[model samples]
Target: MNVGSTSTGTDALAVLTRVSAGYGRNVPVVSGVDWALRRGEAWGVIGANGSGKTTLIRTLMGLLKPSEGECRVHRNIRFGYVKQRDGLHDLFPFTVREMVDMGRMRGRRLPSDRDDRMGQALETTGLVGIADMPVRELSGGQKQRVLIARALVSRPDVLVLDEPTNDMDVAGEQAILGLITRIRAETGCAVLMVSHLLHAVLQISEQLLIVHEGTVHTHARDEAVHKDLLSSRYGIPVTIRPGSGGGLSVEAIPGGGGGV
Candidate 1:
C-alpha cells in the first residue's frame, strides 16, 4: 500500500509496487508509486492536466509498460475501462444495443446468457426504451450511460472511468454521477475513476489518490482532501466551502494564493 493508505481489511485486486511509468526509460511521467485496488473499494484519482494521471492509469491497465517497478493484477480479475472520450459517435453510426453488445462480443463465442446480460445492463442504465435507437443521436448523458452499460455488461471486477462527466452541463453531470452510485450499490464491484470534476469526485470517493509532480499519495477522503492540497497540485489559489447536498465547492482565486 502507498503512504497514508487506509486498510479496510478487504482483498486487494491489483497492486503497484514502486512503479515508474511513462513512454520510455527517459520519459518517466510518474515515479515512486504504490497503490492498490481493493475489493468493494472506490477511489477517485485527481490531479492537474498532464500531471501523470493518464500515465498511471495506462500502466495499471497494462496498456503501457512501466519502466520501473512492478504492477500485478491478481489472476482472474477483469477490468472494464471507460475512456475520457470514445471514438464512437454519430459519424460512425451504431445502434445503442449494438454498441453495448460489443462489450460481450470481444472475439469470444456468444454465450447462452448473452441476451439476458445485455437486457439487464440496458435496463439498469435506463436505456431499455432507446435500446434500438441510433447511438449517434443520444444526448451526452445518454452516451455516457451507454458506455457505462457496455462496461457493466462485461461484469468486470474493477470498473475504471476516465473523466466520466467531462463536457456535460451541471444537471447531466450530477445525473451520471448519481447513476454510478446506484450501480455500485447494486453490483458491489470496485470502482476507480479519474476526473476533472473535483467537487463531485471528492464527495463520492471514499479514498483519494492525489497525483502530483511525479508521484502519488493515497489518503482516506476525510483525512487529506482540502483546499491547500488541491491548490498545491493545481498551482492556483483555491477556496473550498460548503455546497448543496452536503458537498464542498471548490473555487479558483482570480489573482493569486490568498485566503478567502
Candidate 2:
C-alpha cells in the first residue's frame, strides 16, 4: 500500500510515517502505515479482532514506540482518551461532578477557570441535570457520557475513544453514537474512535483507517464504504447507500448462513 510521504499533510495534528508498531517476539502487528489526523477531523479505525487496531492507536498516543518509522504529534496538542475499560474502582462511590473533576490537570495550584471549564464540560455533555448523581447508579449511556465529560473538561485538541459502544445494548449504543456525533459538531475537537460499530463509524467519520491483512489503508468516506470491500472481508452480503447528515448508511443483508 502507498502509505504516503512523511512531509504530506503538514497541517495535521499528528502523522505516522511508515510506522511498524507491536510488542514482543520480534514481530509487528502493523507495518508501513501512513496516517494523518488533521484539524477538526473525525476518524474511525476499524479492523477484525487482533488486527492491530489497538497497536495503531497506541503508537499514535506515544504508548508504544515505532520499531520502524516515526510517529509525530503537533506541539502542545493535548489528548483526552476514554478507554474501553476505565481503571476506576467501582466500589468507590463518586459523584458525577467529582468524577469529571478528576480530569483536571494536577499542579501546585489548579487553573483559576477550573469551575467554569467543569461547568462547560457538564453542559456540553448534558450531565448538568445529573451532575450530583452517583456514578454507580447511572445507566450505561449515562456512564459513557460522564467519561466523555471528564475528557472534555481538559479541553483536549484530540479526543480518543476506544470502543465507546462495545458493550452497549442497541439503545445505549445509539445514544453514545449520537452523543459522539453531537460532540464532534459542537466542540470541533478531532475525534479518533476505535469501534466495532462499523455503520455508526461510517456515519460520523470524515477519514478512515481500515486495517486489512496487516496493511492500513487510508480512505475517504466514499472509498471506505464499498460493498465489495466489506462483504468479501466479512464473508456476508452487505448493503450500502447514502445516509442522513451527508454520510453513508450500510446494512447487512439478512438470511445468510453467517452474519455480516
Candidate 3:
C-alpha cells in the first residue's frame, strides 16, 4: 500500500493559493497556504488536534470560504466526502443499499443510471451481500465501509475522507486501508485523507502535509522525510519501529515542549 512512488497525473485537480479560513471574523486557523493536488494522487494530511486540519479540508471542499487569499478546485472535478462521523439518522430508516444510492444523486439526471451505479458501488465495497440490512444494525467497521461505498457511488474525480479509520479495531483498520488501496488501484481517483494514525497514512498516501500553527509546515512524498520534519517541528525525537501486522510504532521523547 505504499503509494510514495506513485506519480500524479499531469493536471492539477485542486489548488490552494495562500488560502486562509476561519469561522466568523476570527483570525484564520491557517494562513499563507499553497498546495496542489493532481489527478490520481493520494495525499495525507496530519497534525495535532486543533491544528486546522479539519479547517483546511473544509476550505478545500468549499464548505468554508477563505477569509484571505483563495482556494480553487478544478471546474470539472467532482468530490465525494466521508466525514469522521457517518451522521446517519435513525428516523430515515434507509437500508444500506438505499443509503449508498443517495450518493449517485449528486449530479445525475437519470434514475436508471443512479440505480445501476448504486448496485455497482455496493459490489465494489463488498457490501452487496448485506445491501438490504438496516444501517443501524451493522458493525462500526461495516458502517464505515458503507460510507466509503456511498462516497464511491458518485464516481467522483476527487475523494476526501476525514479520519476514515476512527472507531475501528486493528483488523477493521486494516480492512479499511486495504479497501482504499484497492479503490485507488482500480479507479485512479485523487484522494485526500486526514488521519491521526501515521502508520496507516504512510501505508497508502503518496504525499503528506503536516499542518501546524495554522499553516502547512511540511509537504513531501518521502515518509522518512515526513518523520524527520515531524520530529523537528515538535521538538522531540520520534522513532518509527516495526509493529505487528507490518504497522509502525512511533516513540516520542519526553520533555518535548512541542504543541499538540
Best by TM-score: 1
Q: Give the poorly placed runs of model 3, Cα more than 4 Å off.
A: 1-10, 107-112, 223-227, 234-237, 255-260
- State the lDDT at 215 in candidate 3: 77
Model 2 segments more than 4 A misplaced: 1-9, 85-88, 106-110, 232-260
lDDT of 1 by residue, 1-260 (tens): 22112333348878888998887557689998988788878899887777788788888888878778878777667678887655556687788899899888653465568989999999998999999999989888899999999988888888898889888877877888888888888989888889766777776689988788887988888865577877887677787777545667667786775532
Span of 10 residues, lowest total lDDT, candidate 1: 1-10
User: lDDT: which candidate is best?
Assistant: 1
- Candidate 3 least-lDDT 10 residues: 1-10
Model 2 Cα lDDT, one tens digit per residue, 1-260: 22232443467888887899889766889999877788789999877677788888888888888888888777657688887645444688899999999888743456679999999989988899999989988877788888888888888888998888777776777778788888888878999998655776876687788776567888787787888886665556777766544445556787754543
TM-score of 3: 0.88
State the lDDT of candidate 3 residue by residue for 1-260, as single tens digits. 01121223448877777788878888889888888888898888887778889898888878888887767676667788888755766566679988887787755474567777887789888998999998888888888888899899888788898998877778988998889888888999988889866777777787888887787854665744445777764446665677545977555655554422
For model 1, name the residue pairs that clash. none
Q: Model-by-model lDDT, in order?
A: 0.80, 0.78, 0.77
Superior by TM-score: candidate 1 or candidate 3: 1
